[model samples]
Target: MSDPLVIAVDSSTSATKAVVVDKSGQVLSTGKADIDLLTPGMDMYEHDPVQWWESTETAISQACAALSDADRQRIKALCITHQRESFALVDEDGGALRPAILWLDSRAGDEIKEYGSDHIHELSGKPADTTPALYKIAWLKKHEPEVLTSAHKLVDVHAYLAHHLVGRWVSAVGSADTLNLLDIANVDYSDELLDIAGVTREQMAELAQSASIIDTIKKELTDSWGIPGDVVLVAGVGDGQAAGLGTSAIDEDVAYVNIG
Candidate 1:
């Protein structure tokens, strides 16, 4: 029997990348596409969600196309790792309500202050900043009321991709935890937060375990992208989580930092 094939998807502020590997972690194929980050002024950064999606799709398709049929069929699972905190609002029809506010965007700094620095820090385990979803959502509602009112769901980078791949809106615990909408203690959605964001349970995606199988590749997506029918789609964790796993940083004291 051949080794099980694995694929890893990394979507971040700057780019989306996909890599195909065997059970032994030997890379077979890799592809990447960069998404342009727009900065209209100081403390304002954004990206077109449609472009991001297109880039991700192109990267994954290219990676799969680079592989031989037998290798593709052996694909056992696909994992994803995405940048934390960036968010996009989508309408009921799955169209983006507006451009995604990236993690680095700081136009919401004052809005974050309204939530109180200490309260946010205690609840989120991170200092309240422009990077947190809470502030971004608040900023959107205030500045772009029309867009916010029409939005049917607020999603992070990975959730958006998962929806496209699996035909369901699902979010990962790791990513959700960074959203400021989930309680850090219980790791579940916070009602107070949903109320603050003007969203309800029905407007949110279901949360899934980071390593659990979220869904198999849908037949239509597989057919369109020429992916094997047996490919498994694993609910990916945040980039930091995936790096910790990849580097065997399993202990609490283990530290891994990225600097660029």
Candidate 2:
């Protein structure tokens, strides 16, 4: 007779939050973990990739600790949403290659000038702004070419977390759209964009639709967190997309703004 429960995780720039919600749309529990934002130089922001994963696990654990045994058992899914336009590189083993470049990084100013064009803008729904991940990735090719070639996967936060959670290097299409690498109209990767970023489609996570199952949580995480091994891991949209969903502004005509 108990309401079904769902755990939602939001991994943003400064912090990660985990909220447990029931079928009736009320939040049953909430938890958060702070992350350090590194500003190595002017307009360059970075986050330790390891810290992202660690903070996510800690936040989810904190959230679940607030739930009762019965409530935890009733949980049906783990859903994740995150900041848009942030990205990192991972090895074949899912080990992080380096700190993640933040969406605001201006290190690729020159590359932006070169790659910025009407064709690219039309190909990707996003404009050629510093906010997109590709410009900074191009900067990596010019300055640290080895890093780009050495990387096994050019992933967003969702792909990294999904790998850890479900053993799949796949991400929600909606979340991957933030990378500026996908053809938003087609909801898939753009070959031209990949060439500009110095990566191949093989180096990206397999795409899954938002709200679908990427995979199930692995036994290791389930055991460590005291969650069921069979718990489903659902693909989640970008934070902006989630906001629209949360606000009941499902129509494109309706604008949802976050004052924060």
Candidate 3:
């Protein structure tokens, strides 16, 4: 019998990575790609979504290439952990609508204030800030109206990668919650927020649980990358949530803090 395999993809603010692990959580292979976050001005940081996609692809391909055919055949699932809130818009054809505004982009400070920070905190359990997609969307609409008008979907980083991997757009509940467009208590996008952001429901990806299987690896990609075509792609959670689970900090009363 073969050892069961799992692939983990971590897409964070500074880089993207992939790791192949056995059932025992021992890593067999790992790959990483650095991404440059561009700050063109004060309160504005951006990245090319196309570059992000390429980085993710490079990481996955490199990881898979390091495995033998027998090792690849044992792969059971591919799970992702990603940065939250940072997003890019795409047209019907999946092409980027514009450069993605990162989580640290504060160009939407006025929009966050307009949405009323107290009200946002009450609804989403977090204050309105540059870290939420709502503010970024507002920034795009105000300053890049052309791009906003062209966009058919508003997608976070994970959803974008999932779409490229499985050939379908999917959003995770935990990730969606970080968007500030979702009612955290209800775990769905808020109509009130749509009204506030002037976006329609159709603009968002369908939501699924963080652990749900979204799709299998598409044959072309699998063949090209020497990975099993039947590998399951699981819906990804936000990085913080995945870290909590990996570190066994899911229990209440425990808080994980990052100093840097």
Largest TM-score belongs to which candidate? 2
165-208 per-residue lDDT for model 1 (tens digits): 88788888887777788877878888877777667777778899
Kindly list the per-residue Cα lDDT of model 2 for residues 129-161, writing each as its tens digit: 888898898889888899899999988989888
lDDT (CA) for every model shown?
0.80, 0.87, 0.82
* Cα lDDT for residue 105, candidate 2: 76
Evaluated at residue 52, the lDDT of candidate 1 is: 67
Candidate 2 colliding pairs: none
Q: TM-scores of the models, in the given order?
A: 0.93, 0.96, 0.95
Q: Residue 93 of model 2: what lDDT? A: 90
lDDT of 1 at 46: 86
Task: Tally clashing residue pairs in candidate 2.
Answer: 0
In model 2, the runs with Cα more than 4 Å from the true position are none
Q: Which ten residues in a row have the lowest lDDT in candidate 2?
A: 221-230
Indicate whether candidate 1 or candidate 2 has the larger TM-score: 2
